[model samples]
Target: MQSTLERASHWLALLCKIVAGIALLALLGVTIADVSTRYLYRLTEGAIALRVIGSVELVSYLMLLSLLAAMAANVEKSQVVVEAFSHGLSPNLKNRLHGVYLLGFAALGLVLFIGLLDSATAAARHGEVTQDLRLPMGPIYYMAAVLSLLLGLRSLIHALLSAVFGAEGEVSHGE
Candidate 1:
């Protein structure tokens, strides 16, 4: 079961990274189109009033999605750790410290996931939407919440294993 879960978790992280990559590419394309259109319109003295409505809103949401989607992969790779004060620890001690750190990260991710869920629910209740495109916000929030939950669960499991086995069964992924 643990092996199965490990495989599942690895696949999940890979999926998240793929989603994040797509989101980043979409964001780049949207930004370039928006800017090019705006510049053309300005250059033509309003002759070409080419404007992508809600481009800003779309970009913001995409940015958030990109971050959220990449989060699980980062957790799996131990890429989110700070490096300001841990230059002196031995490998074993560092492993233990990472376990503790992952536990704290899991708690933080759970809190953020709950907040995202609550905000999604509230948005759904209020029928909230983007100003120009009228795109619904609830679904985006829910997506973020799901990603956060995935990351939190992965972190919790990795932390538990590392705490118990001193990084032998860890999900640090060679970190």
Candidate 2:
């Protein structure tokens, strides 16, 4: 009973959640390894010589990816509502207002997507790389831009559903 767009959005949200989970796991693993290495090094009086090079840079990238990837799934679930102000409003009006609120988020996501794409283009043009790992930054920026685009699209869909159809209940929680 769902449109293709709705089904696609659901699938995309699922994919994004999976990506977020993987990135989080990777981040945790890196942090644990780095901490263990540092502890062992200190305990061995620097004889072990084990250190995670570029660990900080890696962690930062992973964190950003995870956060961005989660945005699509969190859009509807994370909205703030003022019950006192809206309690008296009719349900139809509330749905329209919520749609407008979601539109704002869609706008924000679109802006970020544009900015990230520009940054990715510039990074690719300049052959930029991460400081510690020397990994190409263009790909990372492009990935982030894609995620931002997904967020925007998802918000737009929710906005349409709410405003046009007055759909109620949560669509997804990224679970």
Candidate 3:
């Protein structure tokens, strides 16, 4: 059962990374397009209005959202953590520390998720909209909430499994 759960977590983590990679590429493409369009064009009044009112606003906001997704995925994988202590600890201790670290991370993710949801709700109440396109801000907030929940879940599963099985079993760290 522990092995199965660990395998499932690994698969889920892999899926998250793949999704993050795709989002990062989309963000890069949007950024390049935005920059290229700005540098190559001298638009008339109407065209300028359209650019300001359409693609620019959408692309910019979506790129930011996508980047956040990628960042959250990295955090979920513990890739963002410094590894200076790994070499000094026994594998079992290292694994237990990892579990504690993940639990802390999961708590943080939950806090952020709640904060974002509150902010989004407030924005929605105030009818907040994007500057140029006037797109609703609530959806972006909800997206952030979704990403945060995913990270929280990832951390939680790892932490719980590590705590319960640390004595008899452990997740492989390539050690």
Candidate 4:
């Protein structure tokens, strides 16, 4: 069971990376296209108008936000340090500290997750959009909210598992 869960988490993490990469690629393409078109227009029309280009830019910006969220999910995993006193501390204390860290992460994630959902709903109802595109911003907000919620759930699950099993290296006290 544990192995399965670990495998699933690893796959999900990989999926996030792939998604981030795709979003970044799309952003780059849009940016290049927008710039080239504007440059050509400026040479011919005597001034650059970025209306359509700006719409693309808005999408690009949203993509950037998505990419950052994905990257954070992955980078934060390894960067999460619970080792305030790992080497010199007893095994049990170290495990407890790790559990505490996991719980903290879960709490943070929960807060962000709930707030994001509400924000997304409000944005949708308001028909919010970027000034250039006038495209609905609700979808982007929704995606972000979902991603954050998943991250939170993942952290919470990890916390529970660690608490039950102790650190990876030590024998679990209960079982």
Candidate 5:
């Protein structure tokens, strides 16, 4: 049962990484277009006004999503370690310590997951929309909430593996 959950989490983290990568690419494209448009407008002296409303706002929101989406994969792979005091500890001890840290992350993630859900609900209730595009911010907020939940779940799974099964190899931990 535990292994199944771990496998599922690994797949989810991979999915998140792919999605985040795509979003990052989109962000890059959007940024280029935005800069080019502004530059062209300046060059043409308002003759070629390629102004995109809400472009800045769109990028801001998309960046947030990209970060959120990538967070789970990073956490799952133990790439965000602090390594503050693991120099002298044995491998077993280090792994256990890492596991404890992961549990803390899991707890924090759970809190954030719930908080985002509430925020999403509030945004929906208020019908929050972007200033220029008039795009409802609620759906993205909810999407972020979902991503947060996935990150939290991944953390919890890592914590459990560290605590119960001890530190396994990269393949076992879904490197």
Candidate 6:
């Protein structure tokens, strides 16, 4: 069961990384296009009207998605650590402490997932839409909720692994 879960988590992290990459690429593309169009319009002195409508809305949504999609992978690999504080601790103790820290991230993810779900429901009920693009807000909230749930599950799994298996490939700080 543990191995299966680990495999699943690995695949989940891969999927999330791919999604984050694509979203970031799209965000970059949108920003470039928006800026290019504006620059061209100015350079042409009103002869070219190539402004991208609702670019701000697109960028904001894409940024949110990219960040959220990266959360599952980041939960395991990109945690902030004060190595100075844990430098003297034994491996076992460090692993246990890391497990607790991961649990905090799990709790945060779970809470955000629940809140996003509620927001999705409310948006659907009220027919809420984006200000500029008029895109339905419910689906976006649903996607965010799914990503948050993945983060929570991945964090829980890592927490268990750290607590029970003594941190995987952990590096000593002062070594």
Off by over 4 Å in 6: 169-175
Which whole-number lDDT from 0 to 100 does residue 156 have in model 2? 86
Q: Which stretches of model 3 miss by more than 4 angstroms?
A: 42-60, 75-88, 167-175
RMSD of each: 3.0, 2.1, 4.5, 5.5, 2.3, 3.7
Task: Put down candidate 1 lDDT per residue, 1-175, tens digits, no spaces.
Answer: 5555566667778788998999999999899999999999999999999888788988998999899888776784674445666677666666667778788778878998999999999999999997878888899999999888878887876676666556633453334
Number of the predicted model whose lDDT against the real structure is largest: 2
Candidate 4 deviant stretches above 4 angstroms:
35-52, 55-60, 71-76, 80-84, 90-96, 167-175
lDDT per residue (tens digit) for residues 37-147 in model 6 = 999999999899987889999999888889988987667774566899988898788877787788988998999999999999999999999999899999999988888
lDDT of 2: 0.86
lDDT scores for all predictions? Answer: 0.79, 0.86, 0.67, 0.62, 0.78, 0.84
How high a TM-score does candidate 6 get?
A: 0.92
lDDT of 3 by residue, 1-175 (tens): 7777667666656666676677667667766777666655555533653232365666666665665556455543463435785777676776666677778868877987898899889889999998877888988787777777767766777787765566312345344
Q: What TM-score number comes out for model 3?
A: 0.72
Reference-based TM-score of each model: 0.84, 0.93, 0.72, 0.70, 0.88, 0.92
Give the alpha carbon lDDT tens digit for every residue of 20-75 in model 2: 99999999999999999999999999999898999999999999999999987667
lDDT at 49 for candidate 4? 57
In candidate 4, residue 92 scores what lDDT?
Answer: 63
Give the alpha carbon lDDT tens digit for every residue of 93-131 in model 5.
766666777887788778888888898888899998888
lDDT of 5 at 7: 84
Residue pairs with backbone atoms closer than 3 Å in model 5 (clashes):
none
Tens-place lDDT per residue, model 4, 1-175, is 6555455555656666776777777777777777777788877795765534574556666585665458435522533444654668876666556656767666766787688789789989988887776767788777777666656665655565556655442222232
Selected candidate, larger lDDT, 2 vs 4:
2
What's the lDDT for residue 120 in model 6?
98
